[model samples]
Target chain A: MARVVVDVMLKPEILDPQGQAVQRALPRLGFEGISDVRQGKRFELEVDGPVDDAALARIHELAETFLANTVIEDFTVKVEEVAEAAK
Target chain B: MARVVVDVMLKPEILDPQGQAVQRALPRLGFEGISDVRQGKRFELEVDGPVDDAALARIHELAETFLANTVIEDFTVKVEEVAEAAK
Candidate 1:
């Protein structure tokens, strides 16, 4: 099997309250020097076969269409690994 | 500044309902061949200085204590980038 990873993050212009909350909490927790924190989503898909360019294209489409909201978020898709079974 | 990325994922034995939901929806959405899906969190920390070993150790502590629930989740921290200003 091949593992594909998709990371979806909010656009820089968008307000990320979740990230802000974490950033604010950091100081109280004694973790300092972190100026910003942005929280995002990561998806790992186990594909049944080798991950070729075509597979990557399809995964990119899936990331753009189903995984992320283009209006406010951006996503990146990459092949993480190929299991021994696939090799 | 440097960008540190912390990826928090559920333990292999833990149930991931959100990932299961996405996996189920994929076939319905005309995407197939994905046998399984796992969802996780990615945090981007923009630090005010260089990301050295000491910085990484501190980030690891933060990730363990504040970002992930140690009982059910695992986390990995890596330096994504160091901005030119920090160089």
Candidate 2:
């Protein structure tokens, strides 16, 4: 099977309270020199067959509709390179 | 400032209900050809200065302690190569 990865992140304009919380917690945890902490989502998919262009297109559509809330977030899709499975 | 990205994923043996839910919902939504679906987290950290080896080591420590719950999850950290910011 082929593996596809989808990365979903909040829009740049959106206020990420979770990220801010992490940033604040970092200093308290003694990890300094860090500023912005943006949190995002990643989805890994194992497709049933070869990861051809058609498979990639379908995954992209899936990402647009199900994986991401496009109104507030943006997403990118990538396919991992895999070796052929042993017989 | 330098940017560090942390990719956190659940251990392969762990059951990922959310990912399973997404997988089950896909075919109903007419997105076929997908099988295994695993969901994870991504963290983008913007550091206050140049991304030297020291900064990377610190980020790695932060990732091991706070960015990820090492018990159930595995995380990888990478530093982004950014052009020097405008003066």
Query: Pairs clashing in candidate 1?
Result: none
Candidate 1 regions off by >4 Å?
Answer: A85-87, B85-87
Docking class of 1: high
Worst 10 residues of 1 chain B by lDDT: B78-87
Leading candidate by DockQ? 1
Clashing pairs in 2: none
Residue-pair clashes per prediction, in order, are 0, 0
Estimate TM-scores for all models. 0.96, 0.94
lDDT (Cα, tens digit) per residue for candidate 2, span A1-87: 878999999998999999999999998999988879999999999888788888888888899988999999999998875658761
| Tens-digit per-residue lDDT, B4-86, candidate 2 | 89999999998999899999999999988887999999998988888888888889999999989999999998887565777
